[model samples]
Target: MIVIIDNYDSFTFNIVQTLAAAPPGAPADWQQPDIRVFRNNKITVQEIADMAPDRLLISPGPCTPKEAGISVEAIQYFSGKIPILGVCLGHQSIGEAFGGKVIRAGRVMHGKTSPMHHDNRGVFFGLDNPFAGMRYHSLVVEEATLPDCFEATAHTDQAGWL
Candidate 1:
């Protein structure tokens, strides 16, 4: 089962819908897996363990990780236990949990698109480089101070530097 911890983002269900849709190259037998969604502050770590989810997803939301409830705790508890995918605030929480710095971007990028560049590593692997990516954020994981254990998988020319 796949479990998602929602952080009060409006797009959480949209993500779920996207996941439910068949992938472009998916085989004929491909089907959406069982999924469960919970509020960030509603679920406990023990409850998650009992579910035995194959993957955990942290949803985007307003404010900082400190205010995102149990997201960081969930990430820390399930670091190696299972694969975890963090989006927006969740991603920032990952950085914070791993000793990286999360801070306000030089410019807020609401309803904007940027030419995201990547070396095709990590999440960008198996995809085209320098793709147009939609962005809506005012905070980011500072690349300069990112922990050695992690690397900036992607960036853009129109960055937070304004």
Candidate 2:
């Protein structure tokens, strides 16, 4: 099962819905796994422990980690227990949880598109090197603030990371 922790972002519901949907004419191997969505305010580590999900996906939100009221307890509880995929704000949360910093972008990047330069590693595996992606963020993670274990695998001309 895949557990998605929703951050109450405007895009959260849509993203979850899309992930839950099955593609038309999908192959037999394209199995739709069981998925669960929980709002950040209501979700707890105990619930996550009970679910025993194969992976956890942290959805993006409109504010910083501090503003979102994401507790360090939750981060600590989930870290290293399961595979995690953090989107936008959630990505920032992961960085902040590991003693990294978040900063206001030089320019707001709402509804913008950019060519992403990727090393084609990890999550970038099998993806095109210079793929186009939409940007809708006002803040960014400080590359220098990231732990040595992490690397900036992808970047864009406008946004340093995506």
Candidate 3:
């Protein structure tokens, strides 16, 4: 099962839809994991522990990590123990949890698409180089502030690696 910690972001439903959509021509043996979403404001660590998910996904939100009411310590506790994927605000939370910094971009981007350059590794695996991706963010991660353990896998000319 996969547990999604939602922060009431506008893109929450879209994220879930994208994940739930099965790829065309997937092997018959392929199986989608059972997914459950918990609101950040209402969920507790005990509830998460009870779910025993194979992975955790942090959903994007309008607020910063601090304002989102997610506990950084909790995220750190689950970091290496279970696979975690963060999107947008959630991604920022992961960085901040690891001593990274977040900042406002000079130009806010919304519903724009850009060519993404990637190392073709990890999450970028199987994706084409310079893949076209949508962008909808005002704040970004400072690459220089990333921890030594984390390396950028994708970036665009408009936004460095945020």
Instruction: Pick the TM-score winner.
Output: 3
Whole-model lDDT per candidate: 0.79, 0.74, 0.77
lDDT of 1: 0.79
Total backbone collisions for each predicted model: 0, 0, 0
Return the candidate ranking by TM-score, descending: 3, 1, 2
Error of 1 at 75 (Å): 0.5
Q: Which consecutive 10 residues in model 2 have the weakest lDDT in total?
A: 22-31
Q: For this target, which candidate reaches the highest lDDT against the unseen true structure?
A: 1
Clashing pairs in 1: none
lDDT of prediction 2:
0.74
In order of lDDT, best first, we have: 1, 3, 2
Write candidate 3's Cα lDDT for 96-119 as tens digits.
Answer: 999888889778889889999998
lDDT of 2 by residue, 14-133 (tens): 766765664555443325767887878787878778978877777888778876544344566778886676788888888788888889888888998889999865446556679887
Model 1 spans > 4 angstroms off: 26-30, 118-129, 160-162
